[model samples]
Target: MAVRTPVKFYYDILSPYAWFGFEALCRYKKPWDLDLQLKPMNLGIIMKESGNTPPGMNPSKGSMLARDVQRVSEMMDLPYNPLEHFAKTVFIRGSLTTLKTLAACQIMYPDRLEEMTRQSWLGLYSRDIDITDKGNIIQFATAANIPDVDQLLAFSLGNEARQQLITNTNEAVESKCFGAPWFTVTNPKTGRREKFFGSDRIEMLGWVLGKEYVGHHPPQ
Candidate 1:
């Protein structure tokens, strides 16, 4: 059997850029011959730990990121309408729930991870629903086949889940993560690791993989 190349993604739903990057990955993955692993981490926590401000937060950037999000969303063909005064805590809800979904993937349904990743992103960005809202969170979880919605919400709110999120954030920080849409790719055959950041770098990823860049023509 051939071993598939593994790509590790670390992101937060709070980031429209990350959403854009993930959309690129979804588009180019097959041609790249990759096995994508979605690893959810809160960029908010990473920023706090690293003492870095998000680009959207900088008045100097002058709404570049906000506007870029809309441009990239249209280019990628994924629906996106960022919420106003976006609640930061909602990322925590997603992080914890994503962890639970990943766990569920390990035991029985390995495909659950992909399902949850797509559903959660669309729920937050496409559907434009507030994930911090309990009902919406449950709706996302249910769509992902996550068992026990109330329990998942409780865990996400409780100390343990928060700590897990913190730990994941710290780990990403230790990895020198500056923002969302950070990726760590491991060559399964030779145990090599490469890091790539940003949606624009998706073509570079294809270059590294010795594949044609098809990011401009997204899959229908």
Candidate 2:
């Protein structure tokens, strides 16, 4: 049997692009024979280490990026709202909290991680929900069948899961990852590394996974 390559999907919950990219990953899964391993990381740290500022901090560039993303979302039939409030809010805090929740969900019900991840991303970008809010957290968790939101919340408050998230973030940084929606494919047999940034390279991802890329052509 040929060994399957593992694709490490590094993302931050605050990233709308990650949500879009994840949907693409789901669509490309079977054709590529790819196994995705989700790694939730702190975007703030990743940005600092990479010497890259958040999009909101760069007004002109951020606006352009937002418009581009909106176009892509429309083309892909993905829900997206480019909110002005997102520029003013403390997104890092909410992102950290969401990562904690994901960690708890992963531990308690690993099978639900994909659904919970999708819901969490949609809850933030599509529905404009305050992801940091405890009530909103519970709502998303319950909808994703997270089992016990209260327990998950408690776990998020302490060191066990929080530390794990931190560790994961550190590992991502150590591995030279620079941003969310980054994909790292490791050859199961040869230990070779292949990395891609942004959602635009889904076709290349398909090629790496030995799958056919039959989706709509990515808008130039």
Candidate 3:
């Protein structure tokens, strides 16, 4: 029997690239014999501690990133209808509520984190919904049909969720993570842990795992 590779996927839903990366990793998980770990972290804290400035912070980079996000979505064939005045509203307002919900899910519904993440991504990217709002967060959670949702909702709004987000963010920073969609893949045989950054690194991750690099868009 082949040994399964352990992959720790650290993501922040605020990033379109992280959404794409999460999908790509999920698509390849079984084929690559992976033990995928979904880790939700606070990108704001990661950026602050890692001394990394968001591309959106710069006017030119922000414009380029917006276009790049569209192109990547097209390449991956993912839905990405961003909210109006996304730069001013979504970016400025941040995704604390959504992140807290994901963190709470991590604690309460570990098995459902991926589904919740997918729904959260769709809420922000596909539906153009502001997940930062408490109402929207609850709405999305209930829509996802998560188990113990009321308790989950309360947990997300409490101190437990805040601390979990902080702890996850701190772990990412400790791993030298400067951005979201960061991955730490541990080779079971060699006992080596490798860190990878960005959605573009999916191909390289396949190479590292000794799996076929079938490009970004795999057949549906």
Candidate 4:
């Protein structure tokens, strides 16, 4: 019997790069022999714990980062919208709703977790909807054919899932992941480990699955 390796994907809804990677992950299935785990976290808390400031607060690097992310989004054929509102405001309201909804989806329909995540990301980044709006959240959930939108919403606002989300965030931090779109690949057979960050390195995901990479290098 072969042990299947799990690929843990750490993401935050506010991250455009995570959206891109989430989309990419949706396209690959069992041929890769990978178990995908979606771990949502409050990126702000993670940054604070790691002794880093939010990108939008760093004047010198923020603009450069915006351009770099936009370029990558274009390459991936995904939309990149730099929120006009304050980063903290967006993170507090929008990301929390999205993450909690994701947790609910994970609990209710584990098989459809990837699809739900992709749709949620599209609603936020591509459709430019107010993800925090209850109506919009339910709309996204229903569009994905996720049964019981009201039940999921109840779960999202409930104490249990929220606590689980916090625990997941802490686990990511303990694993030394400091940012969004973190990928952890461990071969269960031999226990080989590989970690990559950002959607730019997603091609490496296929490579790690034993897919031939003729000539590919990590994006700088």
Candidate 5:
């Protein structure tokens, strides 16, 4: 019998690349028989602690990264819609709501976590809806067959839920995470742990898992 590989995926919704990476990872999950562990984090805290700056903090790098994102998405035929402006404060509150709801779903609608993650990404990027919007939050949760979205949202708004995200973010930083779309792959058999950064490394991840996969690699 083959071992089911466990992958810990850490991400922050503030990044468009994280959205791209998450979707691609999900698309590949079944084929890999992966046990995906999703962990949402605060990118700002990770950057500050890790002494890393946002890719776009430098105008030149920002332009290059913007192109890189567009190029990768177009080449891979992935979704590319992005929010016009960065959510100043709306991001923290909104993401906390989603993250807490995700925790709640783990108890009741475990199977729906993937769809909820995807919908959260769509709300910010594709749908032009801010995830901080309560209506959208309920809509996404309910769509995922969540039994009581109203209660989940109410719970997420509490101090406990907010602190949970902070704790998660702190844990991520401790793991040497400096950015979104970070992954820690653990081979169940050998118990080997490996860290990888970026959506661009998906090909490498497949190679490491010894899975027969294509399209993750760039053309030579």
Candidate 6:
């Protein structure tokens, strides 16, 4: 039997591009024989530490970003409401609490991490719901049917989850990450690690992993 390639996906729920990248990877997981590890990190810290200014800070760049997001969403067949939802919701609720919760799920509910992350992104980007709200966090946890919702919530709100998020963010900064949806893929054939950035780079990933370059919307 062939060994599955290890792919670490570093993401933050605050990034719509991360959502696109995450969905793309999830779609290719089985076809590419990938062992996908979801690494939840703080994108704000990455931008800050890397000295990279977010494009959304500039009005023209922000407008271009909205158009790009719409185009990408259409191309990927992924659901995204609008940049308005992003500016209104994410800026208000912030990224830390939501990411810490995801970090907690990564630790205690590894199996459910993917679904939980999807639900979180959908809540924020699709439905314009704040995933960082205390009640909404519990709601998402309950909906995912993660065992012991109370404990998970507590852990998310506690120091351990905070530390985990900090660690993940620090690692991402050390890796020279300037944005979300950062990928660190271990080539199965050569035992070498390769880094990929952005949702459009999956073909490069396929090349490194010795896999076919399936379309973004490969038939299920």
Strongest candidate by lDDT: 6
- Model 5, 2-106: lDDT tens digits are 556788888876677887788778777777877887877777788899999888777888779767877877776766765566545333343655676665554
TM-score of 3: 0.92
RMSD to native for every prediction?
3.6, 3.2, 1.9, 3.9, 3.5, 1.6
Which 10 consecutive positions of candidate 1 have the poorest summed lDDT?
A: 100-109
Cα lDDT tens digits, model 2, 2-111, are 45556778888787778878888876555465577777778889889988887767878766987888898998898788655775444534577788888776676767
**lDDT of candidate 1 over 118-182, digit per residue (tens):** 77688777776655565766677688887665666555655555565566667688888888889
lDDT of 4: 0.73
lDDT of 6 by residue, 80-177 (tens): 98745566666666778889999999999999999889988888888777778888888888778899888998889888888888988888888889
RMSD of 2: 3.2
Residue 214 displacement (Å), model 6: 1.8
- The 0-to-1 C-alpha lDDT of every candidate, in the order given, reads 0.68, 0.77, 0.85, 0.73, 0.73, 0.86
Model 6 bad stretches (over 4 Å): 83-85
Model 5 misplaced stretches (Cα beyond 4 Å): 87-94, 106-108, 187-190, 216-220
lDDT of 6: 0.86
User: What does the lDDT read for residue 127 in candidate 1?
Assistant: 75
Worst ten in a row by lDDT for model 3:
82-91
lDDT of 3 at 66: 75
TM-scores, all models, native as reference = 0.79, 0.89, 0.92, 0.85, 0.85, 0.94
Best by TM-score: 6
Tell me the tens digit of each residue's lDDT in model 3 across 1-220: 8777778899998888999999999888777877788989988888888889888788889879878999999988899875687766556878887888899998998888888899899988998877777778777777777877789988998999899988888878999999978999875557688899998888888877778977765644
Q: What's the lDDT for candidate 5? A: 0.73
Candidate 3's displacement at residue 116, Å, is 0.4
Candidate 1, residue 153: the lDDT equals 59
